[model samples]
Target: MNVLRFAMMAAICIGGFFPSASSDALVGDKLYRNAHIWTGDKKAPRAEAIVVKGARIIALGSSEAMQAHVGKNTQIINLAGAFVVPGFVDNHVHFLVAGSDLTSVNLQSATTPEGFKNQVAEHVREMSANQWILGGNWDHELWGGSLPDKTWIDDVTPDNPVAVRRLDGHMVLANSYALSLANITRDTVAPEGGVIVKDDRGEPTGILKDNAIELLMKVMPVPSAEEMDKALAAASRAALSNGITQVHDMGYDEVGGLTWNNLEAYRRARRNNALKLRVYSFMPLTEWPRVATYIEDNGRGDDWLRWGGLKGYIDGSLGSGTAWFHQPYKNAPDNSGFAVIGSTKLSNMIEGADAAGLHVAIHAIGDRANDNLLDIFESVSKKNGVKDRRFRIEHAQHLSSSAITRFAVLGVIPSMQPYHAIDDGRWAENSIGADRIKRTYPFRSLLDAGASLTFGSDWFVAPLSPLEGIYAAVTRRTIDNKNPDGWVPEQRITVEEALRAYTSANAYAGFMEKGTGTLEIGKLADFTVLSENILTIEPVNIPNVKVLRTVVGGLDQYIADEGPVDLGTVE
Candidate 1:
């Protein structure tokens, strides 16, 4: 039967009609009314009310038309003119790590050497001597672009072993104590895909980039089950507060370890019925065999928690001067950056994962990395027969003009983070030069070319707020306010476009479009209510808009205020 017919019948079965004398008609558990709702559905794009039953939308229409679904048990909530839209879906995030970062040191905005040291010093006082101090995500650019050395925090953290990473997650700064614990010295050889910085005296400066960061992981403490659970809860609350009901968790992995512990934490939450949000988890690409075996035995999980996707890295990030590029960096002259994984190995892994029927998403930041990944994906598709392989390139940040059209032609999704565009805009021009920077984060160009674009926050590296992401995508404004007219104004997209990227497009990216992503009968009742109409407001004001409520699976997961008293039923 057609969708319309199915919806109409479901609506009648819900409460509009009673076919049996013995069984009472089903009624909406909750009715949200008197609001402007953007359904994210092209066929029926607007609504004034929604009736939710159990975990799905029972009916949606004008507030007057929805009164029929109300019964004595129905709790009615008056939105009072708030704007509601499909719940925001973050396409990429390091969920467990982001949760840890929430309670860790606050160094992302430490602008001065003194402040950075003081922050670390203050944090150390709260912990024991042997414990490792992690999760700083500091940005040296805030203090004029000089990389942090161990010396800056070694004195303050004499007792604690400190190992904090740069905001990009590509570089790490270890204190003298941490370096000693890891036995890393000037004599320590940097791996082929990593780097270790040294001073003129040839002493280790405690800065490790790319694969070299693994050296310290050997001595680091693995989080206990309790800690992981706490982190998961914190991360869920943060996401819900930001109107994110679903997140595509880009599972963490490195040379030494995988994210099995993190995945288990999610399972623990699901079992306990404590998972307040939806999760689509991805394992490391190198572990494709394990993923395939698990899928064959257990199958991909339900909507609340699912897996069978693999995430791999092609190169490092731009801020670390490690993003692989075809041309040398303008400022660094001779440095074009290196790949984190060899092309041959990366291609083999992706091909193997695709053949195993597992979803594949490779992280590609620089122009060279993106183009090379696209080539590999194209080749892999031809080698393996036709299937519903939704190959994705995460963080397709920088792209050549030629690579933009290839995304549409190849049916490859460019899963990106718009916040990065504005955050990097402040200094991106200096890194790649004016000529190449023009095409950076070509959101408008990609959409115009017919590529399915999805947006995310990248979490710990960036804010988890989709509202701020929308503002950045629509205004193209730099955080420093240096670009009031927008850093790359021509690349700016509409608020609706940005909203779609955060909503329906993201759901489609995760292969959850049919169940969630939009407000329609029989679909999951997942959405967010805002204080203002972002679609009708100024693009610059988008960031200021507040998330008043977040509903997941027909349940109110977050309420900005104490919440209104239910009016019993809509009579």
Candidate 2:
């Protein structure tokens, strides 16, 4: 019996347990062999070949062992020693917005004030008069610290009503035409939890922060049904190209009808079988009833598209001087930032949503916000008598030492974006002092405290590339190249750890770990093949590693040389 047990262990390591009892009768639909596979399963963490039947992995083992399952019908795919891992799952992304940004003015690379104005001017020339120019994704830090004002582009965009967003999504710069259309002036009082920047002469600077950006919504035009479809298609192609098989789509259009349009668009795509990537959708927390009703009517959707998660914002962002911190920002002595939503209201919403059996994911950027959110999550879970309620804190950017530990204790997942660490690290020290900067984007600390860490792109604000995110987490090198040795070097995590955050950890965060996230039998055959093995290569070269092929549900979604694959016929 002991010898049998040892033999069983070896068989398990080489050939994973078959999905069904009668393993000998099973045959593979596709045989992918001659590859370096990171199975992401602890028991059998490596494999040389995978036998996929339909949309699920039937077996994974040594090339020789898997050959037994490959019958006459199996289509052989020789990987030629390419690196393979579980397909990336971006834990947080505004999907439709990213698609729109791809076609909008390209201002993310504009480093000078002249270049910023030039890009907007060029976009204006292309668009007809009265058309709204949106989705700039401009970074003020890239062109010194001065924020762009309406004056900067008022002359260039005289006819177009421009309302371009800051890269962070916490602020917007509206041109004079847009302000007039919205009826917002120097005298217009900013709404609660928002701010409208004014110049020295008391005139509006066209910069709106937090809730203030909503004022422009009334004047902005709603996207047509056709436009939304195109955006979804564009977004899917982009996600597939990045090797992202799944995304936790944080719903968009907060002011104009609030994601009803976005949700419908996704549904339409799914109905037509147009979705190339899986989506786990989250709606606004304040609208819990709508989401609850949706779940009741649709039964939480299928594996391709799922819902029943609520996303709420506790505060703004650190870059916008709007994160609710415990201490005042070093640059702004009198300001510590404020919560966008009141604690009592936020708690009530969270508790109500929890009672209704919905997943809750709140956005908290500051130390105070994280601490407060943790308290609320703990309270809600306890009151609701917890049953696998995986509460998530989006952008848990800053945290108190206690908050870090409390995440593990309360079983809250920190859904973080690593690129923010490097992007914000450029000037984070100037905003917050060195002391506080030590704890910013502390991936290592969270992992050390036994917290489940997840990674995402926050795309449209940042690029949607998991490789770039992995590089950021492992290297902590700012894009400015100022940190040769890494900016928060102490907080740097290993490449595999970052990959897990992007894959299995994100899968767990979205409650999809059982079906996907690892190259194991009975799991979905969603994985990415890369040109280089990121695990063995130097961390700095990770961003350069190319995604050679991306497969979703047994179908090839993308190929490096040919872009998105059109599976007219499965070979």
Candidate 3:
């Protein structure tokens, strides 16, 4: 009974003084004032007036102590001092392909080959003739190494059928009518793990790696569930205009699929209110027996769509050299990247998803897939004994200080992504060389060995912007300013430890550290205001800050207008 006396006895039992007088008192509406907040509650204290109510956070502090719960129809918001925090919690995303790669054709800034065939001839002149031009992440190391084929986008996709995908969904480029609608020739063959990058006249030069981009993504064209509920309402309005209320998502699937049943398009965007972010899904460990029978019949749901973990793939990525390396690839020396599961079937599926409590994650980018996922999570915690099953690993990136002390003696987590260490520290020391790129994305040596770091933005393979992952974990520098004393500057970290690994170690790796990571009182008024002071910036201006507003539970989803706001009642 002490978190500041349980936040002043839950703000005096939510202001009606205890007896639960039919519990109705959270309508304080809004106050904000003189702002500063940062209450990712390391024992709550930092405030300067909060109040909010009809979505929680009722009463915070000083602005003459929250102007006595400001009422006169509250609604104040004078934050002339900006800064706020919390509302990040991305943890990893893919949010229906980062909102269908925001209406496709980016090709991650096509470097050349006539800028990837003039962006596939302006997405095949605004696509149509049998549609299917689809997303293009593409990255032949930002061109120069050339790779993409089907005669460099088959004369600007001679009548649709593209495919693209390489910024590490582990390869694919496709063209000649998507390799004759996925018949992928030159005697196809290249599955277990994967690779299809061929050329020298054996025929099919459209590349195709990893489970051969599932055979040309199973003949393209699927979308509908109202085109995946309009790409999950434009990926929940670009994840609540980048304050990201909450997401973890990552290959959701409810089975029987040509993909689009992202848990029934997030349960029909939470029954049509068009869900403004709060998912948690994961599944796709090749759909773990229909996600263990839909978490044994809809049990994990609460915070707007939760399907509880499973993910998989212990290898692949590091910008598509298909990561599983212990050695080999210092620029592909007889290559070494394989293992997408098979360490005795990833220790019998992590001892049957830790005896069905489930929560696996896995991915594991190189250092031999983080030493075969810490030797199958320490042989499934010595054959199913360690209880608190928080097990993760996903991109524990290229670790090996004895796999960063087996992620703090096997509690695991490490769900990292600090802008993939400033966008793969520009060609990851040419693919794992400068002495294992000094233990790549180590994040202050996995938080000085106590481990449990979370933060993510593996979104469309980077850029969901948690301030560009807190400016790539406080500037381990490199967005082409070629590593000015950083790239491996002892694993950077500090912008308050990259905002507590993006808000309280990603809300304790998604079990949501008891009601959304931080900001006390009664918790949930999800935050994020900042138009500066990413804790007094200059860590390369924390990727030029700026997210002016973005509350969640306590409404005002994403302000940012900078001026006029009297939209009284729908104008």
Candidate 4:
């Protein structure tokens, strides 16, 4: 009898003996030939062909060897000398927000006062006076050190009250109308973990930082379910087009009305078959009660949409000077930074979440915050008797040498954003001083200690391009080439290492190592084709490498052609 027939007979017997065996049937599908494949499985080198049967890869090798899995009715696709690797997995992202932001007011390119005003004016003109104008990712660094004050936007947004967030999401700029609606005044006391930037007269200047944002955001209207559905659809398409097959989405809060309930919207998209990428949704720490109930009642979803983890912030971000540091900031000597959750509270939360089988991904940027979180992780693991709970330190940006070692020992994954290094490296030293700069985004040190490092682009805070992230990690140089030898040169990683972090490590972080990450047999078919081989390019050129095509689930979803599109507009 043939091996297939023999296996089927054995399956039938096993099914007779054990009723569950009926569910474990293998069905063959098709094959893909004449392609150069990078299987990410370190044991295997590049292969000339691969075979797939029913959603999963069945075999991989030379074309002649893999042909055994194909039948007369099987379909085949020729890669035409294109490179195929595992689909890019983004370890951390706010996918729904990214999609909505794409359609929101774009302020990333506002280089001058005039440019910023013009963009806001255009957005205001399009919106009714009652409607809010949201989502402008303005960065003062890009604007030649000129921070936008209320006066700059007050004139442009006369009718519509605007609340535009800074690129980092830790700070916000509100126009006069919005400020009055929230009843914020110069006398308003800065909340414990927040700051209300005031002018010389101690009057509110329309800029709210960190926890202070709550003072105003509490009053803004919430988006409807339909609006959220639209945002999610847009986000899903964007993810697929960029070759992002999976995302570990850190969800927003319920009280703010931007809750993880958006999963309902995701469900609707999935039912309509509009969801093209897999999303591992995480509940915000504040919504742990709801998450616990949801877990008990519904359990996790299938691969496309699953509730996998819980996300919380220990501290704010460096850009806004809210990161909880051990020492006071170099620019602001009296301020040592603030913590969103106090150390004691954070420890208890981690412990509770760990006990519930929910993985914890915490955002800790400053040295003190990172140290405190490491201590919390250690304490929780020790008490819980660690199994396979893959705890993550989201944006472990700044760390002490001792804290770096704890990550590996405790089996914590550093869910890092590489682009932050390239962007922040430009001004990080100025904020913390040269003495403490060595420990910033210590990618090499973390990897050397055997701690799994995953790469991501904290989208909206930075661009969500894995290619750009790979370039940032490999080169370790700022965009303007300020550090010719590369900033923190010793911490720089190789192109291969960066690629692994972007793919396999990220997949492992999301508990999807078995089904994806590696381009091996039995894995999902997802990969990106680049204009040039990233492996062969010089590190500096990695950022400029263009994406030629993005494939997902054995389907070509995005292809960049050389020809222009017909927009039906006259010259």
- Candidate 1 lDDT over 326-433, as tens digits, reads 999999999998898899999999999999989999999999999999999999999998888999999899999999999999999999999999999999999999
Task: Compose the digit string of candidate 4's lDDT tens values, residues 1-571.
Answer: 2664444334322221112212323322545556666767786747766655556665566665555555545566555555666778888877677677887898988989889989998888878876888888888888766467889889878888778888888878888888988889887898877888888898788888877888876888877887888888787677666667788887654113365556777777778877777778887876666788888998888767788488899898888888989999998899888898778888888888788888789989999999989888989899999599999999999999898898988899999999989889888888898877899999999999999999988876787888888888888888778987778989999988988998899888988887888876556776766656678768777767666556566655666673112122111
Sorted by lDDT, highest first, which candidate order results? 1, 2, 4, 3
Against the true structure, candidate 4 has what lDDT? 0.77
Local lDDT at 33 for model 4:
56
Query: Any runs in candidate 4 off by more than 4 Å, and if so which?
Result: 1-30, 144-146, 253-257, 562-571
Per-residue lDDT of candidate 3, residues 206-238 (tens digit): 877776677766666667788777877888777
The C-alpha TM-scores of every prediction are 0.96, 0.95, 0.36, 0.91
Predictions: Cα RMSD each:
2.6, 3.3, 20.9, 6.3
Residue 47 C-alpha lDDT in model 3: 71
Candidates 2 and 4, the one with greater lDDT: 2
Clashing pairs in 1: none
User: Candidate 1, TM-score vs. the true structure?
Assistant: 0.96
Q: Please identify model 1 stretches exceeding 4 Å from their true place.
A: 1-26, 254-258, 562-565, 569-571
